[model samples]
Target: MLSSTPLRWPGQARASVAMAFDLDGPTGAAMLDGSLWGKPEYFTFGGYGPYRALPRLLDMLEAHRTPATFFVPAWVVETWPRQCQAIVERGHEVAYHGYQHESFFTLTLAQQRAVMERSAAIFKRHLGLVASGFRTPSGDWHADTPALLLDCGVTYSSSMRGDDRPYFIDAGDASRRLVEIPGRWELDDYASLAYTRAPDYPAGLDRIASYDQTLDNWCREFDGTYREGLCMTTLLHPKISGKPGRIGVLEEFLVHMHSHADVWFATCNDIARFWAQEYADD
Candidate 1:
């Protein structure tokens, strides 16, 4: 059930919207490929995101003049410097996804720490960004995940679905709370759009959703979010939503959203900072 309580959006907007992308690229697939590293069959499937889909998606954002956040794996940033550079150059926010797309549940606390440290270093070295936001690759949240993000200076997390609007997690510390910008599977493209010969957990539906239906659902969700003055955070992947047809649907949604004069389109970090300043205890 969605919340009916209102939220205080920035700039007196009726509601807020965040367009975020998980640019996992080949890192995740390769990591999942185990010993078969560099095998084009599964590896190249992810490669398509950086090589083919990214530019198209970027151009679409540019055309819409919309600011977005791209959560990318450290390995992807390291592997495709130019594409990563392009993302930075375009004035979009780059936040941590992980070293690879490995789930925190599969790793020990120590392993998670190492991954964050290495990924943070990559963010600094390559993009000169000390990232303050994180989205887990698999949306896998362990008991220690919040504290781990806090230790890494990640003030905001976009992986949890505890609420329909932004809220704070205890962070295992009485004094400090972590801001959570919730995301739902209904707003993600992976389940409906992504497919593979050998299926994984989210095997992805056998058939891709038609463009009209996708746009309809997205707009319907946004309409409710706007009516209740809550935050709507959508999760997308370049590999899935960057298809020409899907991109068209996204553009249509943007157009419909833009028609509403009171909508505030912003990055996830911007929303988190706003909440910290406005809603956090002094």
Candidate 2:
């Protein structure tokens, strides 16, 4: 469902789309718990994201002539500087995920600030990036996270699932607000695609949705959002969708989306800035 208020897109566009990828390379629970320290297999499994999958995805985006945003952890940038650099070189926005994909809700205010500060510095030093966007590492944030993001110069977040369009999040003061370009779990690749044995993510070992079915669902989602004149932001992961077999699903979905008329494919930063300027009173 969408908000009752009308949302006007730039130019003659009917709806907006933001293709987002989380480049979580060897940085997650496994890395934090030291489980992936000596396990090269496990390490390389996640490593496949930046090492192999990213270049392919970049080329695919370039081929489609589409823009995207990559939410990356600072450690991934530090480990794979050239690969991460290529994301910017290819004309995609690089937003903050976390320092190590840590759970934002589990972190205190001070720890959260520390993570943003450390991450910002790493992005600056390595990629010359001053991130204007963020997606919470764990899909949630602490109470003080919004204000802290403003403090860190982040202008928007694609972490929550409050609405089908762009909205503003007040950071205690009405004068200062952050644009929220919400995304749904249904749009996230990991919910249906990611599979791991040791960590057993999704836990029960029963995961990985059918490619055709997933593509159908993604297209249907785009159709619904487009019909309602809302925004669609995906929670895609390079490690999940960038696999050989699964990349076709993404390609087909993109093709399906591009087939539509007056649909704007934009980066999260552009969407947020437009929302902030257009709906400042809302």
Candidate 3:
């Protein structure tokens, strides 16, 4: 049996594209145990996202009149309220990532629930925003994740790679289901750009792949998804893609996309709500 019923996206567009950012900031790097906070280079590296890349990204998106989703860690939101606020002010969807980019596998179920509650509370109280969508920090989850998110009032999750289109998970409750937006490793920035000595992280490519090569890969995915009338969401990291050279690659892809009139640029929340209503079984 299928996890979710396959359905077309809203507006009859050729394909839907959700340009999402994981605004991790320094939270992931700094919050880790035994982090070199004394040297602070890692923290600075993540901080570059909001301090420099965010403004550039906002300008680029605004100039193109596109709305996007930003999955932010709670620590980042609390540390950089102004930047997080700017995202809300600019009319983008701010969704839950995690408290400090913590992997769900590392936490107990009760711990996971606490993380969700705290992040949601911070988003509401500090940013005046309530998020209905969630993307796990590590794109991995325990079996209970769907039901847990549903309990937290989350409507959609973008962490799974089960399909090219949106689907639903039963969440073990026949009455409630969670929408899965589906993300691919090939479409994520860390797949191409992240380099680390940390034992916990994956190794980057042999060398940073050229911008042209990466763009080609992304465009090819977009082209195929557009032809199939499916959803294609590109997961970007500000610290990685927000750089001068890499940002151009994204800009070029957007320019290419602008030529197509049939594409729908949407937020994950918008897509999830549409799917829930369109595919809901009575």
Give all TM-scores, in the order shown.
Answer: 0.94, 0.97, 0.93
Question: Which residue pairs show collisions in model 1?
Answer: none
Off by over 4 Å in 3: 1-7, 196-206
1-282 in candidate 1: lDDT tens per residue?
A: 234445677778999999999998877644765743746566777888988899999999999999899999998889887898898799888999988888878889999999999999998898888988999887877887898889889999999888888888887776768899998888898866777664352564567777788889899999998888888998998988898888888899899989999999999999999988887763
Please write out the lDDT profile of model 2 over residues 1-282, one tens digit for every residue.
Answer: 136655788987999999999999989888988888978888988999999999999999999989999999999999999999999999999999999999999989999999999999999999997999999989888778999999999999999999888888899989989999999998999888888887788788576888888999999999999888889999998988998989999999999999987899999999999988888877
The alpha-carbon deviation from the true structure for residue 64 of candidate 3, after best TM-score superposition, in angstroms, is: 1.3
Worst ten-residue run, lDDT, model 2? Answer: 1-10
Model 3: per-residue Cα lDDT over 152-253, one tens digit each:
989999998989888889899778799999988888888777765443345434567777889998888888887777888878989889888888988988
What lDDT does each candidate get? 0.85, 0.92, 0.85
Output candidate 3 Cα RMSD: 2.4
